[model samples]
Target: MVKNVGAVGDFDSAHETALLTATGRNQLLDAMHWIAEGRRLNGEVDGPTLLGALVAAADAGVAGAEPALRTAVRAALRSTLDTSADLVMTDGIVPPSRYEAALANVARRTASGTLVDITGSVVMAAQADDPLVIEALGLVAGLSWRDLQARAYARGTSLPGEADGSWSPSQVFAAFSVVDDVVCGRVEPQVPGAVAARPIELLLGGTASGWAAAEAMREGGVSYGTLLAQRDVGSAWSAHRNRSNNEISRLMVRRVLNALDEAGVGYWSTEGDAAVAKAVLGQRAGASGKPPGQLSIVTRAATGGPGYAVLIAIARDGGTARKTAATLLQLPKRFNVPSVLVLFGTGWADRGESDDLVRAFGGRLYTEHTLEQLAEAASTVGTS
Candidate 1:
């Protein structure tokens, strides 16, 4: 018997009050259709066939099977979209380009409504850690959940949940657990081919692991502040932050190197100048030691200037910018070279301080975020 497939009613009539706009709804529907079609092409039992069977079951008077068949098609469509999201988080799977575009559209729709919708901010705050929202943001922009969390933590900015009564001790434990895992090498960095890809997936997987740790702690009746007070946990987070900053700094350094190479400006590793490299390493040394790789380069100075110029990427705590600036300012006099300090990963909380440092550095300061300007400066280092 031909089982009826559940209704394929118009989306607008079905989800009129959905947070997504009409355009967003249509895009999402199209993506769902694409997924279903792919399944059909792959010889999988498509949604329609499953719905048809459900409808047949309902006609045979299977209890509770009527509603099941009534909206089986629509529900499958929605579930397919959710499955795509889940795959992104759990397996680092990227959805098809069409589905990614649809997610981007939906993210834009939600972001635009955030200002005017009464419950918009609240809803966003509540779902700040949600995997779907995280994936959606990643699709729209390069920002991943880990990037957001790192930025917030770096800047000492409170998340919406932290101030909106939604924060829980469990989240605190989870955060610490994530940091600990990173420090312990349980979550090794996987540098994707593209800088902007799959960070959200990695973060989601880490978060899942963190939640498992949190659950175990809760079962053991650990107090809220217990983990916070642990020196090892605190140190782990500090290490994690340092590592994150170092990664960003390295990327910025690569950009500067590329710019210098393109300009045919001769540059060499700081190792070429032993005294300068030793001094810089000494200046930047911390509990964990100097950052793993070379962060400074020696290049030709302007024609009428000193013999050499030093380009250095400074990756340190934001609060230490002032002290770091003071130390760096002496490089020109002590080393007899013009020093350019690129403040890498300085956060919002210390922006004013960094700006002051930049001004005091006398046109020698750049930031990781302003690579174009930094590149220009690098290119002109020997000519200007």
Candidate 2:
């Protein structure tokens, strides 16, 4: 204690000579005093030795700061901690200790392995859920952490302050969210669709319910066709019913318009596709026809994912039209557009062209792991 060591002297002794009360807390105070006092030249007794002691205390997840520990931490992290940039750690590389671990912590994402690498551009994550992180990881982490995500930086871009790369509570949660956007045909593999997982969230009424609806379709047994037959696609947007592209997101442009016309949601004089049609639905059904029960509405769900088998896409007479649709699907997904909405109203296409859309993606759906297993696929994608 300071008093025991005579730092506070006998001032308290005069009041109570027998006092030995302040030992423990006062000793801690002494450590703090020496730490703040700096080197011996600052009108204090201790030098770097005292300061080092204090930092050691704190570095142990303890109570004070010590110069030795501070220097070691800085030594290890000086390259990564600048305020101007992110010391991004990817591919499950754990961050190095101390100064390197600035701000918050991160966990490996469920969709992490699903990522792809593009050539260029730089973007900072605005928040943990911010889409920018997805853009960065999906495009940037080509080789190593030191590789600079520089490819992300080349085309005149910089990381933003809000980018926070965090994940859901469990594998099930993470898988479920991506599934709704991916498998249940809600979100597809467009440049924009792949940019962030939240576009599907924006559609389907932005309700947790609609999101759950999307998830239900992927859990392996539920059939979206059957559900559509039993229920209805609400005013809220719906997914592709199977995968990202049916060449259908754009086609939905017309179908949605027809629905609007029938509902008397009011009519517009303009003869062109409305602005709302410009957006894509997060989901898609590789097949264009109605499910067994639902007549007019298109169905996108999980079973269609496993129903995927390699089949020949017999080309149709509407070759150019199908080609245009495929090209159209490429755009929004490439740019990370939310809905792509490619195949929205494309029912009149030559039957052979429809088969191509189904074949290409269906072959991919298996590798995509859209459904867990055939037995569970129907129940998960089939039931309510």
Winning model by lDDT: 1
Clashing pairs in 1: none
**TM-score (C-alpha) between model 2 and the true structure:** 0.15
Q: Specify the poorest-scoring 10-residue window by lDDT in model 2.
A: 363-372
Per-candidate clashes, comma-separated: 0, 81
| Tens-digit lDDT string for candidate 2 (1-384) | 121111111223221211112111234544343334432223221111222232334434443433323432222112211111222222333233321122111111222211121111111222233333332332111112122223224423433322233432332232223323332345444586354333222233233343243333323333465446334423112221222233333332333434434433322211243232112121222322221111112222333422111111111124534654464333222221111121312221333333233222221111111112211222223234
lDDT per residue as tens, model 1, 61-122? 54444443333332332211111111112223335554344333333444343212212333
Off by over 4 Å in 2: 1-319, 328-353, 360-384
Score each candidate by Cα lDDT.
0.39, 0.27
RMSD of each: 30.0, 33.9
Best by TM-score: 1
Query: lDDT of candidate 1?
Result: 0.39
